[model samples]
Target chain A: MTAADHAGWEVVIGLEVHAQLATTSKIFSGASTAYGAEPNTQACLVDLGYPGVLPVLNREVVQMATLFGLAVNASVARRSVFARKNYFYPDLPKGYQISQLELPIVEHGEMLISDADGNDKRIGITRAHLEEDAGKSIHEGLDDSSGIDLNRAGTPLLEIVSEPDLRSAKEAVAYLRKIHTIVRYLGISDGNMQEGSFRCDANVSVRPRGQQELGTRAEIKNLNSFRFIEKAINYEVERQIDLLQDGGTVVQETRLYDSDKDQTRSMRSKEEANDYRYFPDPDLLPVEISDEYVEAARATLPELPEAKLQRFVAEHGLKKDDAVILTASRALADYFEAVAGAVDATAQVAANWVIGDLSAVLNRDGKDIGDSNISPAALAGLVNRIHDNTISGKIAKQIFEAMWDGEGSADEIIEAKGLKQITDSSAIEAVIDKVIADYPEQVAEYRAGKDKLIGFFVGKVMQETKGQANPGQVNQILKAKL
Target chain B: MSLDKVKVQHIAMLARLKLADEEYASSVEKLSRIVDFVDQLSQADTSDVRPMAHPLDAAQRLRPDAVTETVERDRYQQNAAAVSDGLYLVPKVIE
Candidate 1:
């Protein structure tokens, strides 16, 4: 084994991401693969291992996996074999998890990741394989053994393995975000991190920056949020770095992230390859997918997020940063384009409102655009109101908040709240004239070369108008008046 | 295959399994066979093959940022073997 301190340390990050495929049925059995079902109620005989029960592949799951492979430009293995990943667990009724091992269904794709510096890098895709999720073990009951919720048992999961090419926590987060975007764009996984539809295990270790030897890595499991991921990896990295600095050796183990302490604690010393005791699952036959099936799934592929982002930047004249922020979520992108198309305004402006005001309100309310009371048409209407000077940007923010709270249309909110922009030159001129009259000393200071105090006069005028006045008109009118 | 017996035993120990001595011989055989199968995978002309990450082509989905509900801590801790002030108790080391 190569020692971690032999050279400069390189942080090699490979993510084992488990995505719950958005299929209506379980992968192997015909049980309803719905979330939030009562415990054990959804477990069918096939899933529960009754005698002579045969495992059948869900066509929808295979199609969804194939669609993902196509979207990422991965090789869909025409033939893939299912194998039993053997381990004893109370939650896994089937003695072993029915997962693809020797022959994964999807192989060798590249995920394009963009950094905060506007640089796009291609991360190597290792393989994506189909598997059935283990039932959740609820250790919250009076029984000595945990209560098993088999609702998640046999639920379809696609395990995406990535190459250990990432060097830092930020890169890992960017890669995760890119993966998130691709999966949502393909419409295969809902990517709900909190509900456990999408989860990640980050393999983190610190070596010298150019070291060939990998450090004894710890696997941080079941991190669902991007914030947690970045925080977890960063904390783990520092912990590892501190250990090395203190002359302590890092152990190979599986660790859990304590959200409270913001530290990683070892669950167990990590299992090696031999511990799984994997073998071909004889109960299921080798999946023989034909060219036609692959073709059909490929044909249904939508414009993936990467391609759409590129189009937005190149065709619609949006900035790369703007395209990225807009295309972070498909619904957000769709809302933006609908509004952008409706208002015929700058894409940057639409992008700004979506990422800034819209996202801020959604974040505050703990909602996405899909759950937000703001519809695309209403949002488009609001944007139009801003574009036409009917409501200033300042008033439009208020209108948006009202719209989000299920209030009336943008026009109605403006009327009811008396929020129309004070664009009338005479009215704005009068307000500016009064402000000039009231703050004559400030006006004299502005004329006496304190140019920065002009903002003070503009603030007073906007305050006098109850923030309904157009800022540009206020600035323009104030400049002429001053 | 017999030479892999020690490696199998180490792996079993790492996984916290209490295998009988008799089971070790069979586990070595089984693990050897499986390792051989995995060895064959490296030769399947995958020089051009990419390792698969996720089984699907779609981006990872996200739920609305809203907190669904809060877990009642007292109810959640009711099943613990030992609890003190809403915390699970494990055996402490040292004074």
Candidate 2:
């Protein structure tokens, strides 16, 4: 059920996202941070915590964190502490994780997310702290044993926490997507959910519509996809509402979403909460950020998504929805800008084709904007042909298909397939005359005030010319002749 | 801040330690003492003092973003108690 379905209840959600930073080396070690290497290969002595080993803070992580802070208009703490959160699992070799506590790096930020009604809503950011990631535990391929891969043991991650301002699952997803776009635009993280670069944990609770006290919450962990995050939050909200309606109080716990079952199951309870015994790490020093460093990082920031979307609408004369789609990704926005620059006067038409046809093909093929085989200039050439009356939109689509199949450029495909529109006025008139003469009955009806018969004559003329006749010219000439 | 026997057992469980029944009492006492010592430091009035996270007030030293390490899968796996196909194998992990 949607949030609206529960009439008198408010579903409150807060998201804690762990975005892996795009760094070449591990956060505390000189080990390669490349994904999908052989197991245990990237774990250095420091990562493995061999006796007498120490962790040196990575400077790139701090810069990227500061860049993200500026992107969200957060305060970049001049002095932030790295504390050790003590926990134990096979994946964590050091028996504790180095993270920020007491004083985090970035705090008190806000991000704007659009609600389902397309109205902007601001969500408060609590804090964004840098931490080291745990290793991977492989449970497959072993009948009675599991394997540990420490390749990811010391990777750097920025844990961005959001306030409980999201009212529904849709709002939560919109907020998450906004964060995803920001990180990608900043070039700090690849934002690859499938590869575990970006992941979220949702804290969900429901209270009476006007209740001031918050209800008990359950944290659903490790949601990697947008679809799963939506479904899991919806399901969890429904579960809590049902329990409360049945006179049962909600229990605070940690849950894991089973995507296959489409339900959440309890992983652990609050009674099992780790003390964490957080304390400052003795080895690493405080991360001090100078005003000069903050300015430099801020200078490196790219034009964000909202500004780009507004520019696309204002400068390119695109509709709001069209601009939103065009600026969904930085690469796509760049591609649209290139096409618009090449096809100057008809930038709106270029926006239509890019957002409509190009997006449809990319979605169908499960490809990204960067994966398109059609270059920006090639699409510009096709749009220019349509604009200059060299080819009809229908034939342009065929040329696009051929271009997608690697046939050749738009000009080459149009020439080789003889698909150019017949702009010769006399030739089009000849086809229209023959079409009218061949259908005298329809023409007589057309003269009897049956203006709809003009459609029949146009279809016949188009068919006679093998769909290459200019449609606008055919309509004008067909009208004058009758 | 003092850790009870039950609290000590819970901590041990979270840490995945298989503490023996005879060890819980001594472990609780030792952990309680450590917690009390840390708690004593918090009793002083330091409202004017800033919470310090590191000993030295130095900025982090940065290295260039480059892959400078070589893979030594076999050599690294040599320290594992059990291994198969270059992976460190242990007891089965259920989810």
Candidate 2 chain A minimal-lDDT segment of 10 residues: A268-277
lDDT (Cα atoms) of all candidates against the true structure:
0.79, 0.89
Q: Tens digit of lDDT per residue, candidate 1, span A158-262?
A: 999998888789999998988888888888899999899999999998886766788888899999999999999988888888789789999888889999999
Clashes of each: 31, 0
Which ten residues in a row are the worst by lDDT in model 1 chain A? A139-148
Against the hidden reference, what TM-scores do the models get?
0.77, 0.95
Candidate 1 chain B, run of 10 with poorest lDDT: B60-69
Q: Per-residue lDDT for A32-109 in model 2, tens only?
A: 899998888898887887779878877789989999999999999998888899876778878899999978999999
Residue B35 of model 2 has an lDDT of: 90
C-alpha lDDT of residue A196 in model 1: 97
Candidate 2 off by > 4 Å? A1-5, A268-271, B1-4, B7-43
Tens-digit lDDT track of model 2 for B1-95: 38887888777777678998999888988888889888988899999998766667665666666666677777766777999877778788665
